[model samples]
Target: MILEIIIEEMSKIVSTIPYLVKYKKHRLTLDDLSTLANDSWLNDQVINMYGELIMESADSKVHFLNSFFHKQLMDKGYEGVKRWTKQVDLFSKRLLLVPVHLEVHWCLVTADFLKKTVILYDSQGIGLQKVARNIVKYLLKEAKEKKQSAFEMGWTVSSNEEIPQQTNENDCGVFILEYSRCLALSEPLHFLQKDTPKIRKRIYKELCDRTLHKKG
Candidate 1:
């Protein structure tokens, strides 16, 4: 997926935000430039808007797991995932588009059911081997109940290297969003850290014009 193509198109597209956030009540002055983004922005902008768009445009079955759903699995175990899985058709959705928020950092994890592999997308360009393993464990337990015996619980996990790396801590969430958007569309990531300003603006415009509702 060409990042430029998506950004360019979003610049011209009119969108709405269905998800809501607390920051909407507060005006963001120039003083807030260096401040980190809140969870509302990350949840709404990255997962709700961008993630939903990726799934809606696809012909193949893609499942967009919300950050809340991820929290449940990460903290509450397989029992928590069981409840979330019941809300969607799991076995049919081969592409599990999960955006994981860990210790104030963001990472994208793709459980390719068909490929039987786990792909971690971190803009920091770091290996989250433990996180990958945790995902596989959850998937293994999940697959059992779903009767997906073909899915290997011990799947190979990998992450990208050429993707942009964030020097600043606040942009990790943004990178996860970009990574998910590109990987969901099967596009090669061409973004870099220097493009942060452009990336932020691109997504800001998208939030203003390309969303369905305000979500947080």
Candidate 2:
């Protein structure tokens, strides 16, 4: 019976049943869920949807940047995303999660305000020094524009290569989401490449339920 249920869901997923879930301001279509089911590269919608779930499950001090925020900043600089935080104060948040899509891969950049550190978590074990630098520069300009002062407090920019690395090309998205999920909950990044399939299913179920299941 469990196998039948799995096959049924997979059939519906491949049939492309239009939109499947709507959480907050984001709506995820069949295409998005299909990516998760087939172990394919996840797109902006899937990343942002899962990100919202992470924000909801995280502490009040946590903040999540929309998936597009990184690309906007990269393409147009601070001016592009300057108005993004008009209502919310990012500096006030303890952790800021930035999901980055580099056309071919997905990675996470987390800003730890309390620790004054910026770390890149890439599943493929690649480093993105420029991403951290640009984010630090954005924070400084944001402070000047919003807080009316220089954010001169030095920040350490580094990459965490010790985290689980993806062995397959398609699991990078799953890995980053797992990275963000673990960080949001203050859990250690201990999951492995072998765990991607299970993690992917859990994420899909969480998305369907419109709530992230806490790690047990």
Stretches of candidate 2 off by over 4 Å are 1-18, 148-150
* RMSD in Å for all candidates: 7.9, 3.0
lDDT of 1: 0.63
TM-scores for the candidates: 0.72, 0.90
- Model 2 RMSD in Å is 3.0
Best by TM-score: 2
How does model 2 fare in lDDT?
A: 0.82
Give the lDDT of residue 142 in candidate 2. Answer: 88
* Candidate 2 residue lDDT tens string, 102-163: 88988889999888799998888779789878888888888788763635567789998788
lDDT of each: 0.63, 0.82
Error of 1 at 118 (Å): 0.5
Measured with C-alpha atoms, the lDDT of residue 198 in candidate 1 is 62
